[model samples]
Target: MRNTETIPAELSTLAACQEELVSITQCAEAGISKHAVLRLVRAGAWVRITRGVYDTNPVPVRDRICADYHDHVRRRAAWIGLLAYPDGAATGGCALALLGVGGLPSELAPEVSRPTWMDAGVRPGTVLRRYGTFPVVQRHGRDVAELVHALAQGLLTLPRDHAVAAICDALREDRICLADLGRIRSLIRGRRGVVAVRAWLELVPGRDASPSETFTRLSLIDHGVPPDGQQIVFRLGGTFLGRVDFAWILPDGRYVVLEVDGREFHSGNGMLADDATRQNGLVGTDRVIVLRFPAPRDSADGDIGGQVAERLHPLGWVPGGSIGPVVHLD
Candidate 1:
């Protein structure tokens, strides 16, 4: 029979308390009894967060304690295999925790609670009502369900997509601010059901009009290109021309627009024809200098920022001050 003495010691060191239970049972042939578990709990070596659930160490604060409680509730609910609920109960503060957005006040932490049936009578604590469907993904060889739960009771609201977009948009606006990105990245990097996390990161819209536009914008921002408004509109000869994705005005009555060429915006022959007509209109007024940037995804040698700066520097638009690289907030 495997020794049971080493099991509690192993569980104490785990990063996530939920994962430690598996090791506890696996270490003994007959499995550890409730009495033994209780002994560990009474000794203060473990914490009985809820019925049949144990946290090996003291939880830091109210939020963590609540999270542990919800985790316990969810595990209990899942073990009984109840119907009408998602496979996994979402823990409180999950929405903010998962997306990595900030702005939560400290006092609000106590309000978040776990989702459970009415009869569970678990303290309402700060559990937020469910908003959307949970997406399932595999992690660490197990099926885990992903869903949003309130942080700080209902003191702070975390909407799934909006929260994600907010973080992504914030990152794009100021690449140096990465605390939120770093925090969320660390939480989800190895967690279960993080496919949604990956998809959110890859598709979340940046400040640029398109993904290609972002590539150029990043290059320019990082390489000291002059700042330009994205999607800037102008009028020529009393006719309103459509907004250009990136625009910089020159002192010589000339305007430069960096058009990051990509299939999404220029895929069909009709789009190509429309683009040509627009270029001609701008050229006729002698008011525009369109610089086409090679799609970075397709061109290995292209440097969109470098190319834009090279063309515009002679025309009087110059880079100023140092800007930092994109930072993932976590």
Candidate 2:
């Protein structure tokens, strides 16, 4: 009989063999045959994952463990340049995990290999592909240092910013709210090449922004402009006057409408003439003040808040304070 207690606890746990590998050696030490180890392997009570590497039936060989083995082989091959691989071909993120960067996804099997490159040592067909030089390379920060090269490789294969923009546009079209974007921003906040992500978010106008309007009224609120009602319908004596972007009603029963002019609203001659006629009608009432902001670009300019403040001051609209170029939301 072999003494299994001779094996270390950590080794025994790692090997998980009922009759430990050390016990087999002990049997040999005691002049017993090595056939007992072979018998255990043949009985399906132990598995040989690799040469000299064995695991008991209770401890399964997971896919990640196998991937790590594959990674080691690829790294060794790459160090010697045995494989003819492409330059700048690396894997990162989930793709890196596929290439055995930090292990495969929990649910995935390790057998499905994808193409990946990392410092020219990555094994091919590990889910990271080398697509020449179409993807852009940007420095990835410390948070994702291990996956930076891979992400750069992937991005190089794709169009610059186009892939990211398409993803953002898809999310926007799906009406995915700002909170979801905020969460994503938080995750990749300090990462390298994240500027593209921020640019994507900027391009996707929020629900509060009007069509063809570059700057949102919500953005205006951040500049110290008081919260104004949106798409407000102006009325006089129960008759519909017109719809205004924002409106303010004073304590003295006076009203002020801030008309935000965009190309869509004041484009052709017909629309401009119609808008003039509407303004004339409103002025005829003598109970309302009309402040017009021509061109959407004006509001986005640096001096917009001051311009707005100057216009509103005489109409009993007081300035809260020095308004910065930040948007405030409730």
Each model's C-alpha lDDT? 0.45, 0.41
lDDT per residue, candidate 1, 1-330, as tens digits?
Answer: 222333545444431433333323422333566667666666666655443344554443343445435334334333222111223333333333322333222222212222333436333232334333444333333323332112221122433333344344445545325454444454455444455454544433445544455556656654577445666665655576555667776776567776666755687899878777776766566677877755554112287777777888888875432212211111
What value of lDDT does candidate 2 attain over all alpha carbons?
0.41
Model 1: residues with Cα > 4 Å off, grouped in runs: 1-206, 298-301, 320-330
Quick one: RMSD of model 1?
A: 16.9
Instruction: Indicate the TM-score of model 1.
Output: 0.40
Model 2 TM-score is 0.39
Best by lDDT: 1
Backbone steric clashes in candidate 2, count: 19
- Ten consecutive residues with minimal summed lDDT in candidate 2? 103-112
TM-score of each candidate? 0.40, 0.39
